[model samples]
Target: MPDALETMKTLIEEINKHNYAYYTLDQPSLTDAEYDALYDKLVQLEAETGTVLPYSPTQRVGGELLKGFEPHRHLARLWSLDKAQNHDDLMAWHTRAQKLVNDYNTQHPDDPLPPLSFVVELKFDGLTLNLTYDRGELVQAATRGNGVVGEGILANVKTIRSVPLRIPYTDGIIEVQGEGIMNLSVLVAYNATAAEPLKNARNAAAGALRNLNPKVTAERKLNAYFYNIGYADSLQFQNHQEMVEFLRDNQFKISPFVKFVDSIDAVEEELEKLVAMRNTLDFLIDGLVVKITDMRTREVLGYTDKFPRWAVAYKFEAEEAVTTLLDVSWNVGRTGKVTPLARVEAVDIGGVTVQNCTLNNMDDIERKNLKFGLGSLVYIRRSNDVIPEILGKVTEEADGSEIVPPAVCPSCGHDLEKKGPHLFCTNKVGCRPQLVGRIAHFASRDAMDIETFSEKTAEQLYDSLDVRDPSDLYYLTFDDLIKLERFGTKKAENLIAAFEKSKQPDLASFLYALGIPNTGKTTTKELAEHYRSLEKLMQAEPEELITLPDIGGIVAESIVGFFRDPAMQRSIERLLAAGIQPVSEEAPAIVDESSPFFGKTVVLTGTLTIMGRDEAAKKLEKLGAKVTGSVSKKTDIVIAGENAGSKLTKAQELGIRIIDNEEELQQLLGDV
Candidate 1:
């Protein structure tokens, strides 16, 4: 019999060629049964010989454990939507938007009005990946890491069967955003032989995407459903939904669950049907994504730093997993801060089997007072891939023993001291876990965004480069990285290039990347705005910090404490010593009040010549009006634009006067 390694090598090459033919060319030379037999043989060989390559087909579902991902800067920001949990929240959002448009029409009586309409779609539960295509050919793929940055997983993404190597459209550079989903049937089929089964399609997709082997990614049958063309200068579409249809016509795999409705009632009915059928379908869908239909409307609605004002995601409840808490352990960090972690019996949650979850701190452990030490019943929930959090303690008899914080550091024998909820280990310089985690965070998405710096890479760098602080990243040479395992000359060069790019980031982004407690992206923005410079921020007093909006007392205190720390202060100084330029905030836009439509309440009824009803409302808003939803006496002016709807009849019956088009509104504002 051939040796296991030799058998695997042969099977891998065969399977890879067949996969390329089946997925890329849509022409399979082998039959389904024949393919299965070959795959089974490869699996059996791997099992018998214990020799598996990262790029092998068997590794596509997932691979060996990942230390962490290398960070890459996003061409455009990946903003998460502020979720609408229920009907009331959705209604409230609509009402608030209505008030803005209504106020505009009321003040500007010369503008035409049209009925407001909303477009809604499904929100798929899967890994959010951004694809950039240059001249219709796929270039790179990235995970949505921290909205502004992500991990580059091009190798794995290239293997997805549904993801086209080249889009049909060849006008200019295009950036498409969508969900990478693993079908339900494929997950079930793959899990049939596993000792543990996957929990959900979304998780399976996530795990598959992160797999090291392209062959493994291929077998998972991962598919892409393009939702929106994030950036395409050459594209022209009247509405967002129309854009999807355009992409579909261009041969891109577009989302299947999309519908247009004239009334809110129709939307509700569609949503109900979707929710009922979602579980029975071949994919996983967590919620509904709703947006204004018109493209012009979308442009006018603009966006916050995080989400588009015109769009909202109605999300469902988080999935739960029940397991046994086998044991509890505490570990101390470099700063001597101790955190409790729950060791649980493996139980599946959201398509991933989780065996452990962090208890966060001593306060969390005390609050739960968990009994499942040896075999207590426990519950887990996965939020992103950090860990399953212990929601509650179920039974005491099955509960393991009472886990307590150790007086000494778990990694080092040095003593621990309690400060607030955390127990910190006094031995700062030598703590291995702290060294690894701290270095990783410094190279994280919010920090320097080093694209090729994985946890394994960090470990390799630590022993060789002797990196102790954030500044050490700037000193890494290409030659230094090339020596590491899996780091080739080209890969090392890419890593060095990313590090160079991060040297000149905005001040807000730089501060947020610092990983300080209570100081995240939003707060970092505030600090950057208030101080305008790193030097000024560093010198600011606690009283000054407390004065800023959203800078709460606790956050203010944390900021002050962080600055006071000698270690943190030294790190900041080291970063400044490096040639990093923290950008200053530009002056805020001055809202002019002398506009003709200022304070008016506008209610649109139909479509207009220049823009859609929603788009017209937005223009009215720019002129300073409170747009409303329903027609009532509170309405100041009703713009009866083209294709007037029920709101127009109501306006006419109420004797609320209307204009003809956006031109009249503009002329009344004295622009014409």
Candidate 2:
């Protein structure tokens, strides 16, 4: 009989050759039965020898199920790319790259750098996998967890047919990063047999890779396409495109749509083509990743604490789908606007289930000729994967009933007032939905932060105890809540205690909790900063309001109009009378005028080590700095943390000063 080691070596070579032919070349050299027989013989030989090489084909059978995933420190950090939503954002990024190259050339003088180029590839909507190969042998595989550390998933990764157990080159360590994706067709087929159907291909891939059972991952048949070389000791490439070419040459799958572009206009043209081709792809793709081509330029540009400064992801437009319009329900918002919500037959769009979508106003409904009935099909679009909106009607049926505006408010049965495109309830005090929404917003974590206070509790209080408004929550006794279902003496006491504890919120939190139209968290913070007190804000005119940063004419008008309302004034008076005294603590005096961040417009991005982003922003604001979200020409400085994306790139392009670590940030803020 042949020696076990020789037999094992023969089996490994044969099986690896077969895998390469079948998976890499899409051609099978052996029948299924023959492959299985060889695989079984290899497993038997490994057991008989009592020795298993790291790259042995039999190891693909997987080991005993793990109790839990073991944490692993990655060979190299995996940073996330910053994203761009529109063509303008992409153009801004391109402009920044050009400027960086020009700056480098100017600094060197003698050895001027070449003009910048970019490589664009499809941004696969799937889980990231980092594969490490030591001396041509697959050693470890991990998922991208917080960039620095990850969970080891070597067993699951080996099950992927396209991933070679051993490569041709026997050299130093090489770490290749790719996205693990399941084809949409394969996902659908798998879901049919699966006990719990997966919602989307991306989720399915993620679930399979993370599963404790390697057999499950193998059964799913997950595939991968390598995009980057995270670490390689011996390998060298001039640019990202060259690295991709090398990966492709090594029998690794790569994105077919990869393109090398010279200008921003060319990139935009390619993006348009991608949008048209995106739906036809076998896998899901949210966007395209654009990277600087030259490795030397990338080194010069460097990285923020969290993301590389050289690349940005340009996201595709929102997806639209057609579904049966089952019914229309008019709901009242905190602003008393009665908006129609279309209850549709559940349909999958971009892997998300869409059942209910918003119809902006009565005018929007009329414009779209949206009829109420079961037969009519409505078009729904998820804008930026956040807002679900009814685009228009796909199919109109004459038998379908026409949707008409309600003469009376649905929640309060009061007369509805027609104001331009919207239908208003105007019953601010009595409207149940409005009251419930407002109360819920007030007790939310971002607001007064009344722990355990929920919308259900707010509804129960409204129906049972006549707790009509936010101020009425303070008046609730234990007896009042005890009468409601699921409410006992202890629960009622706890709720009342929570309400009492929520009597004093910060000025910004209180302002946001009021549910003022067009006033988001950022706007509220800006308003609080500019006015310092509610009394001062209420006294400010629209002209004065428009002068603050990010406060436009429309937003300014909305703020002024909200404060001017008689009912809002009464609500504020009642809240104060009920002992809700919001306070604005005085900001600390600036230590020195020499501080770089003093009175500057700064933007903070990514995960900071010293403190939370919010805490840092608050501290910066206290030091007379205005912190904004986006990076623009107006931006004076950008304080970046780990994984900071497009904003950092844009800041670099605009020649804005960037502070990386918390220590550097503190130095600029005069906190050191």
Candidate 3:
């Protein structure tokens, strides 16, 4: 029993250390298989000894479902920060802070204040969460509701792997405040099967925490980063920066891009840097938080009615504009999804003229209470400085008119279908928008690589010729293309040549060009790698697809559904009948033993001057080298180009050999 207990203790400590390294540090010493072995051993020992530690890895498994959320009062008020929109407002706030500090220094002449330095941190656009730990164990987690009272969400918060269930410190009480955010990549993956896809990461995190099922929250993969000490009974720090350092020392995740600056000018510069780096971050950050570094100064500054006076949030100017709603146009995508596009009076937002914005679907229109009227004003936002969308109705004239979805497809005049939150056109063959979109996608550079095909060409072919589907492109004669606008003898010959080239696209590109729902470039590559041929992929069952790596239930269902469709099957047969054949992606041939890059993993980063990134990767892979997306210890070489980012930094850190240009890469590959 003593031996078992000791083994369990060691395993628990080692697993927790690995967890900290993987989650908090973004570095892992142990492989996933190694970690799993240790975890399995610990579970077995704990089961035999009947001694389950509170911080055991088993406790992280989410299975509980709460009946309802209970209200809890916070120990310390989670005050909201005052916000400044522009540099002038920030300077005004700085002036006020300096005056208050000068007054305090004058009153206490013996203990005069030093020049104020500010700690600037990114203001994450997420849900504010307060966590309370008792005796080193996480006891309660709650939302920041009304600053004083909030709903308990301990079960949901515990499922977030980044939030430590138990810490090393056995302090009396430690209450920390932070933001709960959902990664953009996780959100995109989750939305593949979600009935009602979340609009943004902020709302997704908020909804996940407030969910009644903890398992659902766990599946969403929410992450948290502690930023402030709300109430700690046994901890003290001289300044906010020191408190942040203490949080980091305790294995808590904090913002990586924090800096201390002595003046408002420096703070402004940091804010500019933060804004420039915003799109590069995994999570959303709308602004920067400037807080006075001195704890003594903060004590003197105190609070206003709703916010702390010592700290201010400098928010970036919103990429939004109010525009007049003129009309709504429903467009059909390659998937037959009929999405509504709002035609608005032309207004400039962030230097771009925004005439049309996405309404998403009927559910979105209803949720925003959007009505079709000439006098109605709508608020549109360009999220992430891209993707223009109508946020909500700003002001609506008292018109009793409402925007209703069309019962028939606008292009083909066929009945439309509604599934979940989306409306779809059932006319797969005749719908102009759907056909145009599919043809355009099929001929895209990343798909079938038909270089001569364009949207205008597709439309003209659809209108004038007997072309109805992608298979029809192969049957088009040179005479047919010569009759089209701007199509002389040379252009017609080039079009025929491009069509011939597209008949034998690589397997991955052909799969992607088929317009399978929920399948992106990565999924297509995985499909090609697993099945190797189109016939095998088409015959794959959902059960078999789900067994493949990264192919979840939703993706498997989508793949099976696409192949099972009678129309899709018929289209495939027609393509085969028209002599369209796709070349399978075969394994790279083994080069001579003298080749330096043989069987080695290589990573390429930055903009290659000689060739595109994809072309470079393909070239390296063809030389018996495994091309990887990231740099690690296993990476044999990193081919870096101009303006390389984190991969280059990681390569340098790992002491991996880095080749500067294509010439160096060729030299290593023995192609020089």
Q: List the residue pairs that clash in candidate 2.
A: 305-642, 306-642, 306-643
What is the lDDT for 609 in model 1? 35
- lDDT, candidate 1, residue 227? 82
Our tally of clashes for model 3 stands at 0
Report the C-alpha lDDT of model 3 over 380-435, residue by residue, as the tens digit: 88754355888888754445257878888877888988988998997888888889
lDDT of 3 at 542: 92
What's model 2's lDDT at 59?
Answer: 67
Error of 1 at 313 (Å): 1.2
Worst 10 residues of 2 by lDDT: 606-615
Q: What is the C-alpha lDDT of each candidate?
A: 0.71, 0.82, 0.82
**Of 2 and 3, the candidate ranking higher by TM-score:** 2
Tens digit per residue, CA lDDT, model 2, 1-672 = 357888888888998889878876678998999999999998888788788877886666667776555667888799988779997778766765676677678879898766777888999988899998899888899999868788899999998887887887677899899999998889889888989887778878999899989988888888888899999888888888789877877767788789999877787888888988887998988889988888888887776546676899988778888888888888898779899888888898876677888888877876786754445877788865475888877755555677877889988899999877888998888888988888888898789888667798788888888877788888777777888897777677778888888888889999998888888998998788667799999888989887666777898898889889998888899999989988786766665566666778889886564555777887787677888887776678788876688889988888988889787776655652
TM-score per candidate, chains pooled: 0.68, 0.60, 0.51
* Residue 213, candidate 2: C-alpha displacement in angstroms: 3.0
Candidate 3, which segments miss by more than 4 Å at Cα? 49-51, 192-196, 321-379, 382-672
Q: What is the lDDT of residue 470 in candidate 1?
A: 68
| CA lDDT, candidate 3, residue 664 | 70
Candidate 2 Cα lDDT to native: 0.82
Backbone clash count, each prediction separately: 59, 3, 0
